[model samples]
Target: MKKSIQLNQDNLEQIGNHIPVPNYNRTSETADIVHIGVGGFHRSHLAYYVHLLKNSGEASSLCGIGLREGDQNLHDIFKKQDHLYTLMVKHPDGKIEPEIIGSIIDFKMGTTDPEAVISQMAHKNTRIVSLTITEGGYNFNPTTGEFNFDNPDIQHELRHPNDPKTVYGFLTAALKRRRDAGLPAFTIMSCDNIEHNGDMARKMLLAFAETQNPDLAKWIAKEVTFPNSMVDRITPVTTPADIDILAQNSGVQDAWPVTCEPFIQWVVEDKFSNGRPAFEKVGVQFVPDVGPYEKMKLRLLNAGHSVMGILGAIHGHPTINACVEDELFAKYLGAFLDEEATPILGPIIGIDLEDYKDSLLERFANPNIKDSVSRICSESSAKLPKFLIPTIQENLATGGCIKFATLVLAAWCYYSDKQADQNGEPLEIIDAMQDELHKAATATSSDPLAFIRQESLFGELAENERFATTYTDMIQELYKTSEVKKLMRSLL
Candidate 1:
């Protein structure tokens, strides 16, 4: 039996060659990119790209900054490991590729010291201040698509601007400092999943700035550049089992290592305010527009995850792989993509729609990547609107069939209402509108149209006679029979 070695800067030399360690010298490194939200996706995607550049002897580095208290654990882990962590890429064929990433030179916590966070972002050398703050962190009204000033965090920041908490507060305070110091504004790049993420950041930041100081907002609008980007990589939440498995396989014990699917893509619009790294040199796509690419991905890959997720939970399928492996589920999923999603996606450059759809099914069925159903099922309110809902609306407008999409929502209603799987195992439903959704879903007992009547979410879709009738029938049958798989087979 091989002895497992603790992963850190010192242990890199002792760790065997099977697991590749970073050859770059960290002692003399300086990070010019301040990446906020140092979670799994960032580690696997952006940091991995930087690691490639670093391996090729480019002086690329990133200082990771985490805002929420939840980020503290990663900060401590990075400190202990000297910002060195393994990235295990699981291929469909059960191949494990592990590499120690050394692109992150340091990690900071905004929760512990906001001033230090601001200082780093405002630093002269920091050319790019990137964000991976999740969908909810934007502090915007999803319906109105405007920054919410009434948010408690936004309000707190407005009251005390100097001592900041939220990303908006930190960014505004930092950009103001750079402006006051007569320094060039750093490019505010968003690496989140939202379509036109950079545009959203600019909207929210400018809104926050306008409230604080018109002149500062004007400066930000003029001087700063927010580049729209589309990032794709399925990085599941790391598990203890993943950690232990990586150790047993590679004989290297990593505390907070990240593992992801084999596929990775980054389509960035070349709209940086200041200088940026030669990310293109390391497989980052610099496109004229990321809109089409993003739309294609969201409508297909993400939407597929959502539909499968809701139904998977109901059928007691624990992971995405399990969901796709089911013949009935796979048939319905393929139908949803081919008939529903693909038609709406106008035309994506350099992509074969059939091939892309095939790849999606293959990726979903990869047993090595045990992407959890719960992870996909979490935050249904935020995710469904962005990923799946638009397909339903678009198809509805064109007189196309919405049976697949409608059933997805109907299943979601059943899942939210039952609050458990077919086996009576309670699901950990994580959503911002959890209570409200449950109330609405359960209210269907009295009012069959309850869930669809959420004008905020459904937006008059309930008024559409065809959709409302179909959804009503599906949810009713789901309650009556509780046979999710049988229903899916009927659809196909």
Candidate 2:
């Protein structure tokens, strides 16, 4: 006979002794919140907070709806354990805390049965609809911060609003249902990492809604609440090692286990339309304005990640910790953040830039967290504007040093080559610019100046003499060094 799966109160208690499990209880009452992307981050951050609130005998009405497509595997896994899972927090000091979070009560695969999703959204009890759907899911124009209505998914949803085909469509349909039923419009909280996420979400949702019902759009504009939020946590991709740890320590088989760094920060605008759960009790910072905090995080934390990611990948470093441990790479990252990125970030309220930079270095150098360069390297096209370009633009306008910007662009160009070094190990190039990059790689010109002229990557920055000169010179220097370590050292 197969070995019996072992998960009981005893085993749970043993695990809880080592880590704190969320002592949240679920009443027979229905859910008040629906989270769109039920990924690792959601489990580690938002769900854990909600679970804490529920455990403290507050927000008993709050529960979660995990949205997925055709893949019911997650749904099946959660159902097997009564929608409960252990979240392991890996601290920089080598301490591990595992917690069983139990806020999520239901899972729905909207792609398989759209009607089920629509019905769930139409529920009168649903007051908050939050999302962790990554930047790409929004179908937004990075520069304009507007919904790309021409997106096939958005187009399909627009054409068939009632029988909705996308997330936005489902949301619009659900709100219309609520409006018709005389229920309050649910607050839409975007927990994504995008800058001004709440406003961006509102704009996109409203733009899409306007294309269908102008009056409905106006009503939503007046009634619905979209609260801006700033979220920070370093969540690495789950590995086999994590699975083994969970199985051995927690005595549970979790196919989708989540692991994260100990540090987590969430800042939200103090606004809710249909009321909200008591998240404040669980360390969520409620601020009148999240802009300063958002700017601090976007420029410091995110920008720092991009710098480390590109340079680390080129250096053949596997993880962020490894990259930061290397003397040469660490110096380059520090200079990029402090000298280049920090100077451009205008004054942020209640934050010391130097202290934040030091904390960032410590986080990036945390040996326990294995955040891979490849994970951070994905969607460079989408990430660059938000994380890197702003600093570059600011520095250029203010006549500040452009060395870091130059090196960053060069590192990105090198990463796009899709060629391995002396060991023949391949570098993963993840970006929308892949095809054109490949074409450029085969070109006869060895001049770095010629490469930057490619409009697709640099746009008008290529024509700007100051930027072109600095970027081109750095690329040539990097090519001469031929090794990431040496290239980084030369910059230092």
Deviation in Å, model 1, residue 3 alpha carbon? 1.4
By TM-score, how accurate is candidate 2? 0.92
Task: Give lDDT tens digits, candidate 2, residues 105-217.
Answer: 77777776777777787788888988988877777776666677887777777777877766788888888988999988999999888888899899888888899888899
CA shift of 40, model 1, Å? 0.8
Q: How well is each residue in 103-190 modelled by candidate 1, as lDDT tens digits?
A: 9989989998888889999988999999998888888776677888988888888889997889989999999999999999999999
Winning model by TM-score: 1
The per-prediction CA RMSD against the true structure, in angstroms, equals: 1.3, 2.9
- Which window of 10 residues has the lowest lDDT sum in candidate 2? 1-10
Candidate 1: residue pairs that collide: none
